[model samples]
Target: MCAKTLRSVHEHRKPASLRGRSFKRPTTGRFDINGDERKFKKKHSKANGIVSPMPNGKPTTSKKVNGMVNGVNGHAVVHMEDEADTSSGRGVATSSKYAAIQEQRANLPIARGETHSTIPAISIHDPSFATIGKEALLNEFREHDVTVLLGETGSGKTTQVPQYLLESGLAGEGMIAVTQPRRVAATSLAARVAAEQNGRVGSVVGYSVRFDERSSTDTRIKYLTDGMIFRELLSDPLLSKYSVVIVDEAHERSLRTDLLIANLKTIQQKRNDASQGKGKGKEKEKERLKIIIMSATLDAEKFAKFFPGSKIIYVQGRQHPVTIYHSAQGQLDYVDSAMRTFFQIHVDQPPGDVLIFLPGQEDIESLDNSIRLYANQLPPNQQEVLICTMYASQAPGQNAKVFNATPPNTRKCILATNIAETSITIPGVKYVIDTGKCKEKRYLAKNTGGGFDTLMTRDITKSSAMQRAGRAGREGPGFCFRLYTEESFKSMALSAEPEIMRSISALKTLFLIGGLDQSGEITQLGREMAAFPLEPVYSRAVLASKEYGCTNEVLTIIAVLSASSKVFVDSSEQRDAVAEARKKFKHGSGDHLTVLNVVRAYKDVALSENKSGRREWCRKHFLNERALLEANDIREQLQQTCERLGIDWKVSCGDGDEPVIQSFGQGLAMNTAFLQPDGTYKQTMGQSTVKIHPSSTLCDKKAPTIVYDEVVYTNQIYARGVSIISKSFLAGLGALKVRQA
Candidate 1:
């Protein structure tokens, strides 16, 4: 199910530009690197001139208060340790330890924000930084095996806590892991923290996400998506390399996050118990694992209760008062209401960027066009509205444009999906328009055994509403205009149900793929399947491909299916062109064969064409090159995995597509459906009737029997990525009778 929430500070703060230079910090009293307090004699600077507190020490036209502009970088001091050796004269240079510490302190974002000031301060504006002393925070972590920290948005917990543990040497010789729900958050937060550490990414700080990873042995603290870490568990079941695992955005409770949470409990118990039996010394203590579960909402109690002895520590967040206004009645059409609200804010409110939250890309695009059409009709005296649309499927260039600075006399308006609701800070947003609606993906389990994903729009939970409103307050005092009434908000659920409760359990999917036995225990085959970063079904397909002697073709198609973006880019204006281009690779069997054909054609083109020619070829065919390149990466990884598993990835079935289709049938047996008397298809294992998706090549074809990749419910139950299969071939697969436990 697709889940969307409002803009809230769930985990990260946007990093400001460092401008390719570092600045000196104030000569504040010394602080201990190990979370202790220390004092040293102040050193004098040789120059009497004032150094601008900003990066590069340059003056700007923008006004600043306490070296800050709208709660962002300006004259902020981050005193990590002493600057020089205090045992000797003031001019004496310190040892390499002090030098490294000084360099690190200068590189901090807060230090770059500061001017030449003598005032001693340590992020007084951040609730977590201001309220929780470094020593006290470390002490709690040192004392507890697990910590349930309830920190509001902008609390500095996500960014600061890792640094705190690293500096205090609490992480010992092992790396510290911080898991995010989204890849964008994982990579961006790593960049921000790397900046804070005065080091480059992939060195002191790194991140690992699917298809892309930038981490090395030098990395001390790593940020990775929950899915990546969960995959890591397959290789290192006990997570022996990590001393601490901080699960950020625990409130979101995504499917992968829930899996990690459950597995962590068992992993922690085993690791800690084994370490405890090793003689109860400091070295053995370092072998134990530590967990910190952080949430932005009121669900910390739930996590605390789950961990039993885990301590719940609440950290106040630095938030400016956000004036919230609810509508007098319900909004029948949220898109229309959002458009009206944007124009109202543009014509009536003071200057500042406006952020409008929508349910999905369709709504975002609708509101974007409406706002643009109306903005042109506004009087010339009014500020022009600059619109930016954001969603998961948007191009990288389009998403990057959202972070660009607003032009003079132009009011920036961001039309975003729930992606903007958490772990991202959109600058210049002082007014928010929340559409109290979101789309959630739910798995409708059938009594007969199979299930389909349902993407349905519905009212958001109260926690989501607060998160959406919190976006406006990121920079400074802001206002939130809720499209729904206060009563509507009050009647909403307190929080979202954990993803495990809404979707098919991962264990069930694993069991279906023979990853687990009837007794619910992982098998050796399951362990091998987990080695590849793929869905269990796709992994099963690869294994079956080996037996079918179509490993080469199956790998190509599965890689494309696993790509983050769609293989084709569809545009309304280019519908005819896209259709005509698609005909070159269209296969009569269906989408799966069509994908293999496209990959083969691309390979031929790559061998014959130059870089520019390859780009032109892709452009002409309306193919997404990024998706192709990503697929290539996944295919390479899968090939290596296959080699390790003693399965020849180069095994091919020549030019015949039958073996490839039959191989997929082996893995997708449960996804099979047969033609019904009413000219529709009924699932082989379930009673649900489904139609071939319009995008499928076999949309209007009368295929007697077909196997699909998945079924999605929007306006109707539609089977996507379909291929025809012989009934006799499907009947040979007796595994379809495997019942749910």
Candidate 2:
């Protein structure tokens, strides 16, 4: 599942630009029309500098909040409130505002620690529904170990049954953490449930996202990301605090979700004895963990068999009558035909936003371009529909717009990835167009080695098609147009493959972190890695940082690279700036040394000014302030890892440029390459004929040389590869190979 909440770096301040150079930050000024000379939350804004917060699912523009713009470089200081009130006071009262949600959870005939207002619940009273459905399901479930949940959209099983366990108190004080594949659902559902219980959101119905957190100790019904819940397992093996764990959006088959199910099964076989729990009152906390799996169209029967004694409850969704249609014309000129179909539906049919599914990023971009270009040519009456794009790679501001409503008389079009499939709930999506395609990432053959990573675009799975179809039928009777044939849909995979079996695992990461064997089970050092809230590789980097006394350095890199908080200034000027950076390092080594040399130079420059000036100066050099922030996080994690190993991270930050190469080489040792007799060098683990990316330092020059810069494990070798040798080693390796040449 995707991360629930990605942090916002720019909220109000405008990105500053300088003449004759790239964007420059405030080096000395207190305010450049924006206060405190803070970094911009967004760039290229036409609006005056005003920052605003989106609180009620409504989109608002920048207007300073309490005199503060949600500036990118601004610190996110959680307004520490009275923990009690902040935890549970307003959730129940506020949740009463929604009628449908209130009817489902609050009005149910149930017992609880606190009494809820009496309201009648809508029940499925069909005789057939009661007799053959659940009872028949029980018999099928009794004989199975894993089950797939197959139900239409609006299935009550997703939300209601989790409450079934809660009301039964089968979960006990042990928490029931349900992981949603998307953030909006996690946060919205958490608030809805908290309000039902007459408690605060964070208290009993809390959600823990990346930047926005609303969970507290009183919280018993917690909603989190699939990955977040998975990581939590490493911290609490038996999940002693939670009695029931629900994996929502199982059809998505995200990488972490797959790992979570497998890990859960692993834990179940060798159940962690309650007596072994690290938490206090551990044994008394030993409660049977309940596994509840829910999905829109999953094969629930199969999943039930996977876990013997597991029960599957199917709840029908509130989906309205939806009519499916195929494009009028055949395959050729289909994109144009698709637009005509969309235009006809928007004008002749009804008023609601349109959800269009495409193969991948390229397809989404192509379809969106066509729509926008057509909008300009349309009549004045047709030009009113506000067109927007939605994809994972989109900037933060753009993604937010897809969820908000369009102005009156204007229709909004949402172009999304499979991410829009199940977890996210977009209002007004009454029309859906399916492309029957999705981009998938997979590893190439090991014989090709690490250099050739393949990004294959494949046909959508059957579950993906159902998910796309469900998007249209949410509000009322809607229309869906399919680009492919029904036969093709039937031939598709039953479900998207699970992630763990497909993608790269932390085998290398775990090996380094815990020194574990290939299985990634615990090792001496890995024991500490298991305690961290990050992936094994990320944890290993932190541990290694401590050993090298570079704790401060690693943290900054991680925070910046993490992409969530950074404004992600993809400036073309980074290459030019590196050229300038090398001038300070005396060009004694290579690009790795260039970064170290430049960072030191920047820090020294900062010492002459305040931290505010430091940020401004960084932007001027095409450097990212947020990257520096992440680097600091990586450093701190490393420092902590070292302390756990009884090592003090007090070593001074080093400055010698030549020694820096050797330091980088040890861990990046696997990246090293050697020149062959014919002058072709092998670099990748699979030794594909790879070349450096244009952005790498090695790409700028060529000799009888083997350099490491711009490396990836695709079907083809790429650039920006990092190597284990210094520039001097290049000369030595070149000498031996030059004779062969």
Best-fitting candidate, scored by lDDT? 1
State in Å the error of residue 403, model 1: 3.6
Give lDDT tens digits, candidate 1, residues 219-258.
9999998988977886798999999999998988787887
Query: Per-residue error at 428 for model 1, in Å?
Result: 3.2
Model 2: how far residue 53 lies from native, Å? 43
Worst 10-residue lDDT window, candidate 1: 1-10
Candidate 2, residues 101-132: lDDT per residue as tens digits?
Answer: 44544322111111111111211111233323
Candidate 2, residue 129: how far the Cα is off, in Å: 4.9
Candidate 1 Cα lDDT to native: 0.73
Q: Per-residue error at 326 for model 1, in Å? A: 0.9
- Residue 308, model 1: lDDT of 72
